[model samples]
Target: MLENIRENSQGLVAKIILGFIILTFAVAGIGSYTNSVDTSVAEVNGEKISQAEFEKAYQTQRARMAQQFGEMFETLSNDANYMAQMRDSVVENLVNQLLVDQASRDMAIRISDERIKQTIREMPAFQVEGQFDNNRYLARINQEGFYQSSDFRDYLRVEMTRRQLTQALVSSEFALPYQTSLLTTLQNQKRDIRFATISAKQFEQGVEVTEAEINDYYLANPGRFENQEKVKVNYIALDVNDLAKDIEVNDSDLESYYQQNIVNYRQPEQRRIAHILIEFGDDKATAKTKIADIQTRLNNGEDFGELANALSDDTFSGENGGDLEWFEAGINGEAFDQAVTALTDVNAVTDIVESESGFHLIKLTEFKAEQVKTLADVKEEIAIAVSTQKAQDKFFELQQQAAQLSFEFPDSLEDAANAVGVEVKTSAWLSRFGNAAPFDNAKVIDAAFSDLVLNERLNSDIIEVSDSLVLVVRLNEYQAANTKPLEQVSEQIKTILVQQKSAEKAQLLADELLATHKAGDDISAQLTANNASFEEKAAVARYGSDLDASIVREAFKLPHPVADAVVATTVKLNNGDIALIEVTAVSQGDEQAPASFEQQYSQQLAQAAYQSYVEALREQAEISKRENITSTSQL
Candidate 1:
């Protein structure tokens, strides 16, 4: 089998293609805005940005945030208002990118075919067993809506140019030494503070949640106590690997393919050559005589290495027994190349050749002409290639058939399965947030929950589950959304009610205590009188302190204390507790700033420059959203 083509980061692609986006945004702390949709939802300087396009970009960002937010993703996504704001943010991001994309067009940059292919090779999604699978790459591009490879290449060209432009802007930015020094000093600055915790749990024992409170909370928040609707689907899968097994590759097919793509078989010319040189000596005549004698001795079968090492005046080659490394054509100047080429046979010494340098004797140590693999040598590889292509062609045919047949016979997937030569299979229960593969794929879940399949009891549209698998599914089993029993959630409701009351108590007390302290009633005296407790931490560095990070961040953001007066504030902790913080002193960092500070600050400023440049572009641009589509921008 042919080895996988190597994945290479293309230098040319970096120069002319989308270098700017990845280079700047990924390193500049703005990477989350890299992907967006491109059709007619909005217009930037007259280019259409469709709602569908915007939604695609929004989903991509959501998926990325899901990874970053982890446990918080569920809470954030479930909040309709938050998700709406996120969509508008996505629109803003998309518009910025579109501006860059439009600017890139003015530069008229392009990506070469080889570089685009290299990019495809480097994507792990197109690989199998650590090797780039050409079929998978093609199929994936097809699924993504680029029907032709050249069309995909053109898309890459447009995308790459945009990044190249942004990267150029970011690359040209720099931070001066004084700027970094100042920033590092401020960033590493220390603060001195005393703080006291008002634990919500302390008030919880006295916070009695009555039965009426639990019932009211549960009834008001019904959605929170309900189970997610789940469903099971039966589907027909058309897999490319199964189709490939059915393909019968003939010898003639391999031969024809080899002849059609003969360029891939070439092995360039190679040679190992050597020479003995007699640089014009004290007398040119003497050098000529000496080279002629050396040639005669070589012709008489004197050991070439021994004679050349002993007498050749080209001392570098002489030290290596007159052996030069492998020869490349037109490299050593015309005379030397001609002399080496003129030697007719391997080991045959050339005639006394006089050059500007001196007289020379040359020998062809080894030679190999350009090569092409014959059909017999690569028949197995060719067969595999031919069969895979044929299988892919069949898969496309069946994919279309499955889609059409399922649509034509909308009542069930049986007709489509029969037509596509695949058996009907069933999937287990899955929810909207399922993470199981195959059925859990976003496309599959979307299709399964679509109105046609779920409500109408009709066959779903064919979903491309992966590069190799195509599916058409129908509803089999369904679970309706329902709330849990009152008895089942009573204890959970009680806990929630208790926590809410406790947090209110803690906040009210913390606020009163803060007010009393700010009115010149010394906090220490007030705490002592109330038999309350407090902890004093000195010299709390901005980073790596034993105190809560949220508190630390807030503490640093607070204003520095004036002499004889402390800076004080109340902060909410993650545990629903409240803390009272009093800053007694603040001090600048005295240590030498780290070397990385300059580069880090430079990138930070570069990112800011990029954003400012994009914002300027937006101001100049005529951006319009669809009248019906409401987003945070309109708000």
Candidate 2:
């Protein structure tokens, strides 16, 4: 529904509110959401990071990754290495956030209440038809599964403070005009060069690999040919989706669900209004007198919108003829909300009302009554919800039974399968890196190879594979790691040895040609004598897609020529050919940079400096990790 709300709205309200709402569902990033707990998972500058916070963040990250990777997401989530890294990253971010929070307070960074209100009013989300609407603001904030206005304000305040401090640190970062121009010249510089290729394949006919060499190579790198460790498991599993298929929902159940969760289908009343405010800041009598004149003008049949546009003190609302669009009660303030709601007729002007901002003369323009959906209108949705609930209940019950039975009968999975009314299934040969269905889960793989399951022949604990699935695995067979014999890999080693010797010969030829070119020898005549292919490139810049990126990058590395100098160097191409390059001429690029280039260079330098500043802060701060709580066991 919130997603639907965002899709239907085209204002800043959707952007701001949806960004926050989506963040709640996002599980990919590090760091914890604000939470309260007594037992500490870590401590930053004497501040305890609670266990609840760590668990929540860890699970959220796991779930987010699972969703992102689809089938492979579970494999990554269950990986011990991945889990460890994610946990450490989350803790590090939390510590950094705490450091920033402390710094913000120590520096006396403050955001006033009025400023907060103004910021909220200025947001495009709260505006309708180019002006701030209090009702729209209230509607967005009132949506469930998002932060309350107070909490959101606090978040915004902290974010603003952090941004202010960051900008202050990097605000002075700049690149000089001369520096940018110099770099631009180098980036666009082109070179005229001729390259002669010496192919390794030409030398391959002369290269030979001996039987003894192949034997030696195979013996030296035996581990390279070793077979991976593999396991087979027999498991009893319960999946929630399977249970959901059997779930039954009656019409009465649907009716009961609709009655209980009816608010989800409720549409609140919305009001559109135009108003004239005369601010009484430090001078009430003057403001009252001004409002009286406006009231008289309204009584004389003058257009209310035109008058409000010209006279209202609220600049944002005044720009749109004091139009505040589509809002429910409690959005602005109690006094203002009551005044707007009490109006019964369109174009009716209210008596002078007082609020924190000032005195207001409210005029109603449009209204929409509250609406509630009939039970029949939402019957299918209710039925689906009721069925899901029942399915979840059955799944939990089966999971509990399976867990208990698996523990009681640790030697075999047959008893657990019988108890849970599930079949014991056998898996194909599973390896550590394999990502097959069911057995792809890291937890299942670890449990299958665990000492208890392998050596003691005990049933593993019930491992939760995903939100919908659980597995109790018993190892059926195991293959010990072993290296393949030298005979099996001798032919493979021979091919590699032959290629290496050929490449060495080609490089030697390229080097000889390079020395001749540097010594002022006629390499073009030498290349013609040897029947080598010589090709000339008129101009080549620092970047291009048509030529080899590696060769192009190497061309720029050559120093500028002095007095008709011929600089030579050799590069190994991807096809095992040696490219011996000799620069005959060079053209330096323009030194004056365009405006866009200058801006880009300046921004790059600023970003680099900001990263350095952040790193320095982390290095200077005192950081500590809890001994009992590592990423591996946090959850």
TM-score of each: 0.48, 0.58
Per-residue lDDT tens digits for candidate 2, residues 171-197, read: 777888779878988877889877888
Best by lDDT: 1
- Give the per-residue Cα lDDT of candidate 2 at 278: 84
| lDDT score of residue 141 within candidate 2 | 63
Residue pairs with colliding backbones in model 2 are: 12-124, 12-125, 13-125, 135-327
So what's the TM-score on candidate 1? 0.48
RMSDs, each prediction?
20.5, 17.2
What is the Cα-based lDDT of residue 357 in candidate 1?
Answer: 51
Write model 1 residue lDDT over 1-635, tens digit each, in one string: 23332233345665555577667756756544564434366788988776667767877888899999875687787797887778778878888888888887777766666677677778898786886654455456767776445566778877777778878899999987677768777878888888888888878887898898888888899999998898899999999999998899887888888999888877766667677877764588888888888888887889998887899765445656777656655433478777776665788777777755577787788888889888888888888899999999999999999999999988888888888898999888889874577765778888888888889999988788888998889999999889999999999999988888998888898889999877777667655554466788888888888889878988898898886565788888999988888887888885467777778878998999998998889899999875444433234
After superposition, candidate 1 runs with Cα above 4 Å error = 1-181, 210-229, 242-373, 386-425, 440-442, 458-462, 481-491, 512-533, 544-546, 561-566, 599-635
- Which residue window of length 10 is worst by lDDT in model 2? 28-37
Question: Which numbered prediction scores highest in TM-score against the true structure?
Answer: 2
Instruction: Tell me the spans in candidate 2 whose CA falls farther than 4 Å from its real position.
Output: 1-169, 206-223, 234-237, 246-248, 252-374, 400-429, 434-440, 457-459, 523-531, 562-564, 590-596, 608-635
Candidate lDDT (C-alpha), each:
0.79, 0.78
- Candidate 2 clashes: the total is 4
